[model samples]
Target: MPPLNSTNNTESENVYNCPPIKHVPFPRSTSYYLQSEITDEFLQFAFSFLAASFQFLHLYRTVWWLPDTHMHQTVNFHLIDKSVALFLLILLSRRFWYSICITCVDLMVTKKRLYRMRLVLRYVFFFVITILLGICCVDIYFKHNNRVVYMCYPIIVYVIIFHFNIEPFLRTVYEGDMIYINGSPLHCCSTNPSAIRTEIDSLKKDFNNRFKQVIFTTLFNAYYGSVIPCFFVQNFVFYDIWITTFHMAFVLVGGFTTSTMFCLPANYCDVMHRAALHLGGWTRIDHRVASPATPWSKTTVWPNGSVVKYSGDFYRSHGLTTTAIPSNSYDNKFYMFFQNPAHIYTILSLIQVVIIVTQLFVLYFATEWHQMLSLGFLVLCNYFTLFKMIRDFFLTQRIYESESNIYARNLSN
Candidate 1:
């Protein structure tokens, strides 16, 4: 009885002496449900091909299959146009649905009313814009009046401008200080150094797949919507050609410019690699024995007073880092093409310049007043797109130059 009593007392004492349980709040920044399910490379490619086919078919029909008589022009909705628009709406709405789901889940967990309200407002705004766009499409399709179509262009322009201009403000309000390393959460208490690297690689691959999808859709839409339409039309109105060309240029510019932003994952990899080296206490130093100024040679001092030659492989093996480091060589050919933001932007800017010059030359031959007006409008839109591309190029160039200078300075020191 005494032994049993003593054991009980010890157990009680241990329980009383134990540290109070700390209730660590769940991480608000980390999303539990926001992840891509389609990971297979071949599946991704197949899906992209399917989407491109659908877009091409829709654009081809819109351009080539116009009503044979003015009597049929009274019809407001076509089956093909409505179907294509619905598909595109669904495609774009995926992000919105994801956001709403996330917010609802977050509201249940965090009980934050302000954030929920903000998201609700954003949802309303999206629906309003979508409805407005749908109305514009209906008007343009039904009337077949070039004047009405030209007037509707301003509304489309306003929507695009509003969307792009308000994005930065919206991001600041919505995301706050959440640290996302390549579109994935970086947990504050995570001990595994390789976790972020793995996530980044996955994200990069996903982004590359998505980029291909966008490029295919844009190019197909542009070709079928603009150039192919002109060839098929009986009247061959220069105004129709110019309007479609404007839309094609808009789509191409927006798609390619957005793609250049994906290089951020590579930049993030470089940063993580450098941080790992710094944490491992490795410092670049000139190697007198090998060559007087061997920039790649590095050294580090152990805690036990041992001087060790630094090797990236050796440090990585100690679990300080992983193979997330960006290099010139890539296994995927698509990755290689997109690896350099500056080069991509440079090429894109040149393409934009060529498109603008070609349009201007075409404009000089316009004889009719409406044709001149349409051509002038197209030129203006092209100029705006060109200016945007140039701005993005300079920004990208500056970022790379700054990073290079920082790395060079680190090597020198």
Candidate 2:
């Protein structure tokens, strides 16, 4: 370890109170500050749960209660249902309020206690939402009517998907590889730079592993992908037009927003990996493509003036190598060994396109209220998916550009 000094003390202090890193820029230029103030995981969880609630709760109401009629006998019943719904809406709104308050706290307070509290609140809410969803499923199934059964069949499946995998889901998203990898605690804010780097490496591994799980479970898994659309379709014939509209709109909007989060981990990993490689001067170069004379070969030059061309023989013999110079020692010994999720993303996009096309056709011929709900949902999902895809493209481009600049500057030096 390096000798302790004023510089080392200051570095330790910085780690103790350092604000969480912000990777993705918000759409609004002004919101960049806001993004730093609030944790993305909390924000995304709040939005996803709120959206799921809109679908789950509204379906619950329609499943359990008959439509409101202004008759003397049923007036009280209608009032009770409406009151309960209003209360749930306020409850959901509180999550957004909590997120804003957490942002404020993050800005003004850097206490370890406060940070722990924030994590607690986050887990508490996640648990609450999971339980609430379970309650909704149980309530619907107990009704024992054909209409109720039909309306909640999709929900039952949704509940099952979440229920079974929720443990791994929670581990992957919130904990990542940060927790319980070993018996000892690995502090993210360590006095030793290598320790910190180790923590970050674990974090990157968590991102890759978590994303792989999400892509498999939610996107490409056996039946979960199809079930997402079914969530929009089940309430069609059972609920009143207005109720169906509210439920459908909320589900569609909520789902679209939440689904974007699934892509976040992969995007973050991509940026971080590239950034590490560029900073380390280990980025693979394609000299073969750069020259007209040798238009089809790839080659990379080392900082020490060693030149090597790409070939099966070369790779087998030499394997991968990193720069001898250690400029940014804070970044853990990173390796660009992981495969990019770009192909997985492409396959997901193709699947989404097919689903959207099929859904659109269903909507075009849909004459009923429920069918219209499904249609509205698919349209919203498509819009959001396209928007997210475009945004990711730009984000990736920006990261690559940043990497290129870093490489160029290092090369010049």
Candidate 3:
């Protein structure tokens, strides 16, 4: 009876004096500009322009499939040209179509329907492209006598492979951040922490698998590295070397984009890892045993039975960053890769630099104006690659050094 009386007294006193503790979550930055200071419209325009420019070069090359003679020009579209054109049209139309679909999903559709529609659209598009790809491959192979077909066959193959792999590639490189930004609730609203945690775990697995695929694809796809050189090897001189140079430049641009895509996912992972460390939840340890880094790691259990959530600074720090620490330290392959991104980067840069220098030297020795112009373009593109790679390399090294310092400090404690 005394205990009951004391409990009642305490409850009545507290009820009169205190209010319930309400969770006020940190407001997540909703600005797409968070990732790039540039506006989304600008980014979209840049992407559309690049896509059109590159595909237009491929289209221009396909024109060669038409018979060189004037008499043949009077006929309707040739089978090879028609097929390649249809494929290119399908390819080129995809980005705009995708943008429309995304806009519809965001503005006009319900969440449940949006998810189902995305799955349906993904599989349907893949099935359609696969059929078109096969047809194009057969048509192009049958017309192998055309040097344009020979040169462009490799390009077709590159497209097919990239198409099949693109979903996974994009999921890793950008979708996680997109999902995080989109799912974020207003500060006053509450979300299901468990649901967020589950989604993040799924994202981690998806990212790991997709990132591995990107690495494998980049390494195994020899034609990507060899495309520009093959023109020289075949000794196939074109009437307009400028066109040829542009065509090859298109391929170089594609390779550069692919290389850039590979880096994005890795950088995202590193950003999250750093965020975890900064929030004081994650610890650096030897790679034999590694735990998943999560925002909840920083959660502080308070005396009053409340938990402190991760801060806005943690989320902001992770956005729009470059370089990465491998998330799964236990993964020997990834551990080695992350341990020295600089070394791997240097090797890739030197190989590309050598290739560019060789081509430049050859172009220089040739007195043709087109060759000289090609030399300038090659230098410009290669220099961009060099700058990007070196910058990322140093950034990664800094991440590693900071991590090492953190671990050392902890050990000394």
Deviation (Å) of 264 in candidate 3: 3.3
User: In model 1, which range of ten residues has the least summed lDDT?
Assistant: 297-306
Model 2 lDDT, residue 123, Cα: 69
Candidate models: Cα lDDT each: 0.39, 0.40, 0.40
User: Candidate 1 vs candidate 2: which has greater lDDT?
Assistant: 2
Error of 1 at 172 (Å): 20
Per-model TM-score versus the true fold: 0.40, 0.45, 0.47
lDDT of 2: 0.40
Write the residue-wise lDDT of candidate 2 on 1-413 in tens digits. 11112233455563453322222332333212223313444444444444444343334343223366434341123322232233244333443455565556666766867868667766676677657655654554454333234333434554554555443333323344344312112333233334434555665565555555454333322122222223333333243455445444434433443443453434344544433442222223455532222111111112222333333211111111222122332332343332233433444456556656666766677665444754575467565665555455555456545544654554455
| Prediction RMSDs, each to the true structure | 16.2, 11.7, 12.5
Q: Between candidates 1 and 2, which one is better according to TM-score?
A: 2
lDDT of 1 by residue, 311-374 (tens): 4222111112122222212322222343335565577678778766776776687654444554
Error of 3 at 93 (Å): 6.6
